[model samples]
Target: MKTYHAIQELEATGIVTAGITRRHGGVSRVPYASMNLAKHVGDDPNAVATNREIFFKQSRLTALHYCQQIHSTRVIDVDHTASATLKQHPEADALISAQTGVALGIFTADCVPIFILDVATPAIGIAHAGWRGTFAQIAVNTLTQMQTRFGTLPTNCEVHLGPSIQKCCYTVSPELLNQFTERFGSTIRKGTNLSLQTANTIQLTEMGLPVASISVSPFCTACRTDLFYSHRAEAGQTGRMLSYIQLTTKN
Candidate 1:
């Protein structure tokens, strides 16, 4: 397995640099196996740092930004001045950046990872969307932050939906599924497996972004244990993948 999962569509866009991490190519114990990018998942700090260094060197990003990620809609801005060595990242689900050479990273096991880049500006963003964050409209709120701060327009934004547990292996309880269906219209279900990407796409399109502006990944983390990590599939004991995006600070 490769060290990263990238958005091929945005790679050609020149200013946007983005990718996600996989389970292979790192130094860690079983369950984490190798190449786990998150520290909160019981992986050794030194091992996690080594794995991140591999990704940082490969990506050529100047700085990296991450959040505590409490399944909330909180958004923050990261630029050149951000303290790269800070141990405690802000508690936020989404991070937007207008600085060059800075990367925004979101860690996930099975939840959706969404990357958004402004086609016309040097602005980029990454969001971690679990069912709670999605239902709370984190994606929408992230867009709103970009629009307000960077003057970004959704019409000119390219969105990438990274690997997550799809409807095939993601199932919720009857009461939870009923609640989601009532709020977001009937979910496209396979015995209660929720289509998170679909729900997010609906909200994005409703916010004036063209349905075609989004590029979705076909890989399901739950189904692809050989490559990625799945919290649900592994019963909450697993490593995490890093979903990242950046604006090349190169002048």
Candidate 2:
């Protein structure tokens, strides 16, 4: 496997291996560039399949379970059987699984990919948090599902907020600003700039997760255009990046 150890610090937790991918190491051209993992975003299907194969091969993950994400807060628990049935599963924004070797993958092109792992349990989760899903509290919902389904407590879980469009470049309309203020009041932002990272961290804290257990990547997708694809920076014509996490079985 052509593994990248850029996130080795996160791996020290002994429960999860998480990292954000750069726009390299796959088969696609120009607009889709390279390393694009999503098939529904107008990229060539063959190239997407090839990209997925390469991604799993490099990460050493066997199979990836995907969600038909609809920017909602709904989260589902995936087992070996549920992993095989993802093609027909409901459109949800998050996935949690204690099933080993079943990689939970979520697609994004600027939106956040939040990965969670419980050190006390064999559980892992991945979430797609766009502005809509973030505002709807998908991260909280994912953590709640983990506690409800796997008996994992928030304090025992470690979180990694992967690369996404950061507040440095994620400007929003007045309508979105007003809606955020109306819903979360002062907790969502410091000013006109809506800090999605802060909002997610706050949600995790409210769930009893320690402040030190959460880590946010400093890279901004929109700002670091050379490394990541950004939908806002590319005017809605960008390829999606895949953030995935899975547990390896003891065999």
Candidate 3:
């Protein structure tokens, strides 16, 4: 929504609508600047509401579903029956749905946003992958959940890696690096930075997802702050962008 930058492939999908927002086009100010989507990040609630409304209107989506990302392997199922009333948003890093109208949304600053659409089954999933979430294999875990919940096959799923902090701007701890190397081997290391996008792509490919269905966004949030909000790039004082997917019936 808000005419934000988006992944062209995902945008071209006829059955599902997917997009990622940028740092432009909203009421947030100063450090958060504009188009800030997260409520807990200290932006005024009314401003966030206005931004969200603009996005919702522009995207033509139904009520959005989101979660409290704990950088873990937990994945939540969102269905047509899912309700927005919650004591708190589910604490999970990924969300999956077979339902149409409803959109699955994941917020990120510099962290990775992985979106999967099972085109054959008309279902979708979205994940928030910070280093901890990646280390927990959130992408693979989400696919596994989709398989169980929607009978989604990896071959029929299209994966999109949205703008994030790539190896050029990301550095991990030695312990973290060891864990990554053990799982994906040392080829993931590009100097001190860990290639999170590549690592997740590898994990998905190893789990039987088609190589051709995966598309990685070339924009790095930290490198393209003019079009995105980057937490690490902004010294952790920045706002967040929303990466989302929706399964909508043909009009």
In terms of lDDT, the best-performing candidate is 3
Candidate 1 lDDT, 106-149, residue by residue in tens: 89988999998888865888899999988898899999999999
Clashing residue pairs found in predicted model 1: 26-35, 101-249
- The TM-score measured for candidate 2 stands at 0.91
State the lDDT of candidate 2 residue by residue for 1-251, as single tens digits. Answer: 24222455457765565665667777888798888888878989999888877776777666677788899999878864555512435798898888876778888888999989887886888899988988889999999988889998999888888889887787788789778778666666655677788778887898899999998888888988788889989999878887877776765
Q: Which consecutive 10 residues in model 3 have the weakest lDDT in total? A: 80-89
Model 1 weakest lDDT span, ten residues long: 79-88
Point out where model 2 deviates above 4 Å.
1-6, 80-88, 185-187
What's the lDDT of the predicted structure labeled candidate 3? 0.85
lDDT of each: 0.84, 0.80, 0.85
Worst 10 residues of 2 by lDDT: 1-10
TM-score of each: 0.94, 0.91, 0.94
